[model samples]
Target chain A: MSQAIDLDLLPEPTTNVAEYSVSEISGALKRTVEETFGHVRVRGEISGYRGPHSSGHAYFALKDDKARIDAVVWRTSFAKLAFRPEEGLEVVATGRLTTFPGSSKYQIVIEDLKPAGAGALMALLNERRVRLEAEGLFAAERKKPLPFLPQVIGIVTSPTGAVIRDICHRIADRFPLRLLVWPVRVQGDTCPAEVAAAIKGFNALEPGGAIPRPDLIIVARGGGSLEDLWGFNDEAVVRAAAGSLIPLISAVGHETDWTLIDHAADRRAPTPTGAAEMAVPVRAELHAALASLHARHGQSVTRRIDAERRHVTSLARALPSVDMLLALPRRRVDEAETGLGRALRLSLSENRRRFGEAASPLSPNALDGLVRDKRADLRHAEGVLGHALSRGLAAKRQRFDRASLSLQPRAMSARSDAHRQRLVDLGRRLPRAQRFGLERLRTGLDAQWRVALSLNPDNVLSRGYAILRRPGAGPDGQPITSASELPMGAEFVVQLADGLRGAVSTGTENAGAARTKRARRAAAHEATTPAKQGLLFE
Target chain B: MSDLNEPVLPPDDSDVKRMSFEEALAELERIVSQLERGDVPLDRSIRIYERGEKLKSHCDRLLTAAEDKVEKIKLNRAGKPTGTEPLDSA
Candidate 1:
């Protein structure tokens, strides 16, 4: 099995080869890749796409049936990518080829990429539809019931597009309500992310914040190419649609263009205008419906009342008449009254019979006999009492005569003589006592008179002190001890040991003070005037 | 946060706006049913009928009196909606 090949065919191994580090070789290869295939467009089916990495840089492999090439989309490039790379999607990726030194692998750094063709895009969408369907995102049960009439409707679409204007016009023509538009790029590299964000943002709105949360959401776009509408097929957009708390209506393209969001949303409208129509009922129609409802309500109520009234009337007719119902009771009452009168008359007659039977035994003759018997007994008692009384009276008279005989007049005369002598002795002693008392009282009066005389005003006058007074003021004038009390030219009195002497007030006897003194005396004599009023108010 | 699973949050009453169309409709229906039953007394029937009339009027008013408010969400640089602006921005 071992066949020896020619020695010359095997080149000799060189001992002194160019010395180069692994980095240098790798760098050379990297440079060669960058320069030679700086820009290339390759068609392949995307494989191993699990979305972008955490760094936002997408790492995947593009492979045809024959071969596969590693692809790298940097975060910036991925952001600018017109369409997201889907797993199993056929795309024509355009980018520069470079080597990853770390992994020792060559890769294309994609800048711009798109689906290879409309057919390929459709295939990708179908594939996605199947995968998402398997994941239950497209399940009918996941759909939310659209609000009957949303107070606030949220729209996820481009702000400047005709699609938005159409939606607004349609909504205005119909029931005009609060519509909160979450502006997004309907078609571009950022379409999916922006649309998804818009959906999530509307969901994130606080229910009662300054901005009200939307009760319904419509992700709408106008008619465009399949490529233009591809963003709606994005997994992010579909997932967001499926996860919306508010019921969502997808209106991404024309009726012919269907996107994955259509399957995921609660409802699908043919166009943006259709979405608006779906969101709210026509105002005129709603008014008409409400009016009809109101009429129906009124009719039902009136009918119920009429029916109830009829029922009441029938029930009243079935009831017995008041007079008929009371007839038996009234008759019974009258019977009872008549029976009561008869019973009273019968009882009266019965009472009379019993009284007559009892009275027969107690006739007047029998009563007289009883009275005669009682009188005879009383007469016998009286005779006996009189006889005993007379005997007792005779005995009492004899005893009295004996008692009188026993009494002595001499003893009584003797007692009266003693009493007279006692009266005479008492009378004599009382006069003697009265005379002694009179003498004692006279001596006490003499001592009191001596003390009173010693304290008399005459005694003070004899000691060289004379009393000064206002002349003619009183029998005993008010005293004036100081000369200041004298008014100029006014007469005053001075009392000596003998009597009060009148004098006239002349000059030099407190000349200035005298005028004020007289005025003060007069003022004091006058009745006091009412008190001077203090400040009554500020 | 799909409405199919999560409970619908109650409407905010702090806002002075009248009842929403759905609420008014539902209430009107309920009152109609109540009034249709003859078990209700006359006084109570009249009162509830009046209430039903009010609810019906509220629904009707909601349909006609509402002004169109089409405000597009204004987004920040990060593509996050910060608030809203009128749709027809000249």
Candidate 2:
């Protein structure tokens, strides 16, 4: 606060000054910086870092414990940076110290910047990781599960690097997946942004767009120093990895080197090949599993069908036999036969009764009348014959008397006796022939009576075959050979060997029912008629 | 630039690209399982099995179709993709 001691040591100002314009002063200052500090190297921690401006210039500040100075890098020089400048990164920047008159600030126009040392870069990385972790960028919950099978895998790495080759080779060895490489500078000023942009670009893809969306992503790079691998530790790259909708795997540097992206990624692999292995399963293993599943499914279905078949077979075995199901119909058939026999016998008997009634009027009385007529004719014929004979004898006697004078009397008498004998022989033979013809007519009448008796239904019934007759006046009433011909609840009669029995037709003669009925009838018949036992089972 | 040394490139066929290896494998597995279950009708089973065989061969073909093609993504000054080139000399 004291202003007393240094007055004599201060220099005096001259009155004849040049009065230069702001541009002139700024120009002189720019030339002085370009010449004096051209290609100077400065080591300091990066601070207030900013990207290359649209005009191809970067604005930033370089700071030490005592002071901080504004710095910049032209786009051309920035392109040459081996590592990206970040806040709190101790780096050695080589470029001229220049001044921006507009802001009235002095700065180093950086031609190149590199991390001061591996330890410094690690410190910077740890600090960045701490800040990112606080923002939940590396939270376990933010990580996504890798797809079991990724249709495509997007890789963000240098195309010429061994990292990409390792990844591709490993993936080919395992299960080949469609690969899309986003060529990027793995370790340079542009590395972080390029990596981040690649991640975002893959995410921006539509699922079925011209450029297929990657199901998984791998950010990979080969082994390098902490500074060389620092791009993966960058905030932008970490955020991109954390924000990716597609699952990501970080494989940077050797197995011992850990990057911030590793924490942010869904999975972290020790090397690029390892990341490839994590991306897809073994092809043969999956194929084998599918085959086994197929086999198991087949076995399961076959067992089910087989068990069902066995159940059906058991059920079939428990069912009733076909013959047992036909017994009732067979019994109905027997009953119908019996009824027909009885009905026929009744018809025949009725016919016979009607015949007797009609024949009674034409009996022996009529025959006696015929006999009287025939006797009268015979008597008349005998009278006529006697008259004719007497006339003829008188004529013959007259003729004989006339002829007697010319003949022998003894000869004439002999001839008249011979004629009387011939007449007697003829009368005897005619009566005998009529008697023989009468005996023959009686024998024929007896034979016809025997035939009529034998043809009677009663005779057939006595032979053990019954006739069944339905009481109606239609074709159905004639006789039923099949149970289907009988209507439900129809009345019928069965003529047995000795008598007739009335019965009703029960119309339940389906195939199975008829079979059971027939079987029962056969069994019963076998019991009653041993001679038919052999035919029952047949 | 390395692609200049490469031989003739294969003709562009979008069908192969449209069918993903993963999808083909999944379909093959599904078909095999369906056939194994045997719940499918005989005709249907045969049809699906035929489809499964096709899918299996598709997967195999996909794996063996080409060698790993490592390509460099060509970019403009602004880092937008322009095209691609083979990463190797051949």
Model 1, range A274-304, lDDT digits (tens) per residue? Answer: 8888888888887777777788898988898
lDDT of each: 0.83, 0.77
lDDT of 2 by residue, A4-68 (tens): 77878878766788778999988888888878987899999888876668887778888899998
Candidate 1 per-residue lDDT over residues B50-69, each given as its tens digit: 77766776666667666578
lDDT of 2: 0.77
User: Among these predicted structures, which one has the highest DockQ?
Assistant: 1
Every model's TM-score = 0.54, 0.51
